[model samples]
Target: MTQTAEAAAENLPARRESRAEKLLSWLIRGASPAASHLLLLPAAAWLLVFLLLPVACLLALSLATRGPYGTVVWSFTWANFGRALNPMYLPVLLRTAAYAGSATGLCLALGFPLAYYLSFYAGKRRETLLVMLMIPFWTSCLVAIYSWMIILGRHGLLNDLLGRLGLIQAPLPLLNNGFSVVLGLVYFYIPFMVLPLYGSLEKIPRAYLEAAYDLGASPAEAFLKVTLPLSLPGVFAGCLLTFVPCMGDFLTAEFLGGPRNFLIGNLIQNQFLMSQDWPFGAALTALLVLSLISGLYFYQRLEARQIEP
Candidate 1:
């Protein structure tokens, strides 16, 4: 009787699990295709309301004309876009691209080795190091930029330290230049590059490296032939993450690079705020959005090709 009671008690939990699983399966089977799609309504509505609607409005605004009094007129024209591509603004656009590209390159150079170290050699300190790396994000971006200003200003920390060390009699002119803008950009965006690279490198199995070793390949050869190619996806993601935001950034150039270091973002901001030329600003914004979208499309095609046999 005792044995039978124990057996029944053990079977009770299994019976309950089976009943629950059966209920789940029945619910799934009974769900209509329309009902399944209805589950996506909230997410679809969010994108439509927040993303698509704003972009459509921007496109419409870009096609509209600016009144002589600086009001937005409903008249359709391509003049705004043409004006955006004028030689006057072409140099600014090119400079913005150059800054973004420089920052992206520097980030890749720094982040790849750091990520590799974190993935393969950080050992017990990996989590701690990662947390430290992310610590800068805890504060506001403006705060970070202000800190950089303090460090880079003529009478700032770096200059004071150098002066005390007798490195120079005069303070270095570090602020308000293209170099400062790019430095700010690299400092801010390098973490974005490192995290993605670390994720990619960490996912690579040690077995692959071991296999490469067994094939009489040196460590450097193994890394070059096996690790680097597999990590290209991370490189692509990191570059995309770094470059796009760098191109659109205004604060770094505004605070560090000053007027001479103006970027596309600064131009758009001045157009909308200072000049009250919303149509032209919208056109510039639309062009930037289109360019980013085209890049994304190309990346997708490349990724698809890589995935195919």
Candidate 2:
């Protein structure tokens, strides 16, 4: 009787283990392929509703004709695209490109050193410094730009300071110019550049630098040969981030620039809001989007080629 009891007790644990395994298997099997795909439905719906739908509408509108009273007429037309490419708007496009390019270059020049320092020299204070860098983002961008306006304005704080220091007889004409617009773009986008660069620099191992030193390479040579090449990805990412948004931004030009500093963004805004020409505005927007996509595709191809063995 005792031997029988021992065998039953051993079989009881085996039965429990089998039951647990079956329960897990049943749970897994309950999530059918259809149900698994259903989990993606909400995200797919959101993209369709918010992103794809608007782009489709814009595309349709761009091909439609503008009515006599700014309403969109259903008649198909390519005049809007031609209007966007007209000589009148070409300068605005060029100016936008120049401003964005200058801002990107300045961001790269300024951000690289700051990122290098933060990644390599910050040590325990890295977190604190990064938080400080992010503090500007918490404030409203418009408010920050307005503050710059006050500072850069004639008879404002800068002028007052200069007067008190007896540096100049008159206040400098700092506001409502290309210089001010570029300043605002750089100020707003520098952090974007720095963050990417810091991410790239942080991933680089210190051992590589040590090895370079051991090979009797100078610091400059080591940096140019090893560090700079590895950090190109970050540089490209930062430039894209800064340039793309800067190209589309109108607020900086509106607030900090005068008539002469008008950009493509300003022209687009004027088309939709001031002129109420939705078709032309949509065409301009579509062109900008296509240009950006083409640039990104080329960049990706270049990156792929660089990565090939």
Candidate 3:
């Protein structure tokens, strides 16, 4: 009798909470469509003031002309766009694409196995492993990049270890190159790839795998046919996440790649900051945004085709 009373007392607050939630939900459902629209006004207004305003300003700036003294003039011209698209800037754009693509590929290769292991084989330790994977995000990105510099620098950890092992007479040229830039990008963005892949992989029902096995399909064949196809959405999302930022990353290239491996991002940064050419920088930014939008459109088309009956 005492235990039953205790149980009732314990559930009383939960019951009250459930009733309160039901009441709130009922109130919301009873709200008029005009009221519902009013609720979204704040968000819409926020986007307009913050997002749309800035973008409009940038577009205006991109269309405007730069003065002789580096001031932005209200006069309109397409020269900035033409200069950004010219042959002289083609190499920078191409290099940006190449670096971003390389980093995306490397991240996919590394993240897939990690995600696969976490989803399938991690068993009881999945949460712990995930925490470890996310630990890097707890600190500043600048600190993480600086740590890589310490590891890859001429007198840094790797060179010291290699020297100790009698690997070579001189410190290897590990830093200030394309390799370091890509390495930094992969290190920074691998989590973005892994998390999406794990989300998709984990959602795949175990029963499907069991059914495949019951149909006399080998593990390799089953994975190739079922798991890979099911995980393509995650792969696409991960690649998109990694590649887009890499294309606009000036810090990684500036710190690790130096002058010779200049990507479009560095060029944009130079124009905006060093050269004080706001119009040209805005034009380049617009071009980058357009390219990304085109890629997104293609991705949507591909996704839609895959979903077609």
Once superposed on the true structure, which residue ranges of model 2 sit more than 4 Å away at CA?
Answer: 1-36
- Relative to the unseen true structure, what is the C-alpha lDDT of residue 151 in candidate 1, on a scale of 0 to 100? 97
Instruction: Arrange candidates, best lDDT first.
Output: 1, 3, 2
Of 2 and 3, the candidate ahead on lDDT is: 3
Model 3, residue 203: distance off in Å is 1.5
User: Considering only N, C-alpha and C atoms within 3 Å, which residue pairs clash in candidate 2?
Assistant: none
Model 1 lDDT per residue over 1-309, tens place? 999999999999999999999866765775666655566788999999999999899899999999897898987899998999999998888898899999999999999999999999999999999999898856688999999999999999999999999999999999999889999999999999999999989889999999999999999999999899888888888989998999899999999998788999999999899999999999999888887888788887886676563
Best candidate, lDDT-wise? 1
TM per prediction? 0.87, 0.88, 0.88
- lDDT per residue as tens, model 2, 158-243: 98899999998999999988899999999998988999999888888889989999999899999998888778778888888898
Ranking by TM-score: 3, 2, 1
| Model 2, residue 72: C-alpha shift (Å) | 0.7
Weakest ten-residue segment in model 2 by summed lDDT: 30-39
Error of 3 at 281 (Å): 0.3
- For candidate 3, lDDT tens digit of each residue in 193-218? 99999999998998999999999999
Query: Candidate 2 has what TM-score?
Result: 0.88
